[model samples]
Target: MTASTANAQRFREFKMPDVGEGLTEAEILKWYVKPGDTVTDGQVVCEVETAKAAVELPIPYDGVVHELNFGEGVTVDVGTVIISVDTDPGAGPAAAPAAQQAPQQAAAAETEDAEPQGRQAVLVGYGAAPSSTKRRARKPQAAVPAQPEPASAALQAELNGRAAPAPAAAPAVTPAAPAAAPVAPVANGTGAGSAGRPLAKPPVRKLARDLGIDLAAIAPTGPDGIITREDVHAAAAPAAAPSPAVPAEATGPVSAPAAAPEPGLVDVAARERRVPVKGVRKATAQAMVHSAFTAPHVTEFITVDVTRTMKLVQELKQDPDMAGLRVNPLLLVAKAFLVAIKRHPEVNASWDEARQEIVYKDYVNLGIAAATPRGLIVPNIKDAGVKTLPRLAAELGELVATAREGKTSPAAMSGGTVTITNVGVFGVDTGTPILNPGESAILAFGAVKLQPWVHKGKVKARQVTTLALSFDHRLIDGELGSKLLADIAAVLERPKRLITWG
Candidate 1:
């Protein structure tokens, strides 16, 4: 039976449930199924990207997809219905196996008043029953019945060189509703039409808007005849689409775009781009500003002969214990820093203004500043003091890899008491490193190059590098900072100092 025919209560719409444990919000990365597509329970339905990771969400109901309540790239909080499903009548609560009834009982408790009670099949990850959370008073509104388009019909037409219908406007849903209401389906395209939908993922959709591209006009050439981003670029080449146009009145420029057909219809390319300052960069900026103003910074540099450290690195690389690791000078520098922090705990402390106390940590969480393609990110290793030299090197390698992939979680970037930025990797000698917001000290490691230096009162070629220490003078006085630098240098000058001093 058609969804419109079952208007009163025959069909069920399964909203997108909370997939991640205790997760409240997620960005719809991609929708794998459309209205009218058939899917079984456990079938991968959509991909959601939280602040944490990109996860593939599976279908909880074994039925035909009735509607997509949410669009891709939109951030919807937990319990928001992403799609609706029409379940088979025979698959009732009475028929579910006893072993599968556990989550249903929990679901009933959580979604007591909200979810339809006594439903049989539990969503794979979502609770077995509807939510029990009491909802606030809702405004008077009529529920939208489903449309008549057959499942996969419009999608199939798009793949067969026939133009798909223009997508209809989404329904006005109460943001507090369990699931979003699906937008009206567009009319099927006739004849050979050039119009098509964009092929990029949801995040890519946002990127295109920032870059200015219309999805409909872009032709499909990607897998499954989807319109790839490259297609959008080709279509947008002639007329550069600017940033998505915001309502002038809302932006305090109500007088702008007066001649346009409609505010939404305005050319995006003609609009200026504005980015919201949030996330890691915003946090970094605020912390840096606070540290720069509150803590008086003092920087000192020391040029050291590390001919022995370089030789040790080469020997460690060939050793069985350090096999398959990326052994380099930075690893030794990090180890040395840990040793120095032990001798001078003041460098691994923060000056708490409100508390009027200097907070010193007994353990070290080492932050490694890495410059990724996205931006500058410093994801740190937790409990670096506990790990062996080779183990620390491996952890450092993994940290760098995670940051590069933009997969660094907020937790990994937090609780760092000290930081080390290897400017040498970028072929630089040294830099006055900025102290990570809370911490009092940062160490910069320069490139190790063969230079003429005095070794044991004799002129000799040695592997030398420069170390720059930037400390918060309020916590670490010049004397303590200098001593810390000397300790680190002492370790690098002779690798045995780590065992002796540490």
Candidate 2:
């Protein structure tokens, strides 16, 4: 083969793109296709969990899968090549002569191993991977010795530089002891380890190590008989048995009482549970800390009768225009907040620290705080200020469902100009919610309760609820904050204002 032909790039490398805004890395949760599988453009090849959310990446070009640069559960940095595809599958047999097939094949393998060079344009949000293709030459393999014993067969295969065989089928004969179960070979064809390491992700291995549980000892329940996190935790829990015999010194009167065990050492299996904070939880934490410390927050609270708002919610539920849609107190409260923002647009803005400017947003990207199994996330409705009541309700419902399913995209959660967090769902009365990062304000809606109150010189029952508005003091002074809160209360108190003022 000519040097130019060998230098031609036959394989297309798919780098790990920045799936989310400013995200540096993502963990490869799963791979849809293995090496040699056919893939088409726009096919979701893998699922990745970034700091913001779990996203599925689609391949942009059709090709045959040549290699997966990284294994599942590995956190790969943005711009790093994760997979490669053979764009010209037929070129191998057509270009290489029969006599030089072996040499051509070896050279092709080296080319595949080299790092990709030059920027290949990818999908939006992903710029391009770094450019520099270079690889080290591999040393030649040693010859295998003849007639090796069964016990030393694996060793001899490694010495001969043969790839390790796939893990053997589950043994019919069980080990005499549970902890003596044999380890499986590495799944990706790497040579077997001397100690027979088990097939498990790095995180799972770390978990087993931290919990002091042996992976081989635990019965595997995962796919391909791999050990899972649950298996490790279960093994760590001691089986029920009789208590150990106490020393005679404990029974003696002069003996000092046994000191309490350290918190970590006492009932480690049942009493302690450790969960690593990553992905959404980690991002939320960092943003909250930055917002709390950087923004001087001032929260103001006021209690108002929302009976009219609740009645209007029921009316809207029965309205023909609102049929088949979700109508609740939140719907009206959100409308009220939007209207209030319309009245006080200054509250809907962000402080630009670098520019040393108070940037006011004319458009409203209203964020609604949601609590999902993963963590707290705030996804917003874009251009909510112009959306009709029905449109706003629909967007709110979709946003909520997506957040609950832990599928809220980074784009949906970003660009929020103002936010509303309803704490009433958990039966909480009120809370001083911190401002979401970049946004100037967050309105906390508390639980609405029926209470007695003086109305027009007569005692009457009313639906009373408290609203807490938290804002950045640098942008919103007390007077402006108070006016925005009062405007929201007035709209909820008199539901007709939605049509009149809005």
Candidate with best TM-score: 2
Error of 1 at 38 (Å): 8.0
Model 1, residue 169: C-alpha shift (Å): 37
lDDT of 1 by residue, 52-135 (tens): 344678886787776676677666667766676767644443223222344345334333444432222232333322322334
Measured against the true structure, the TM-scores of the candidates, in listed sequence, are: 0.56, 0.67
The candidate that wins on lDDT is 2
Query: Candidates' lDDT values, in order?
Result: 0.69, 0.75
lDDT of 2: 0.75
- For residue 435, model 1's alpha carbon misses the true position, in angstroms, by 2.0
- Model 1: residue 9 alpha-carbon error in angstroms: 12
In each prediction, how many residue pairs overlap at the backbone (N, C-alpha, C within less than 3 A)?
A: 14, 0
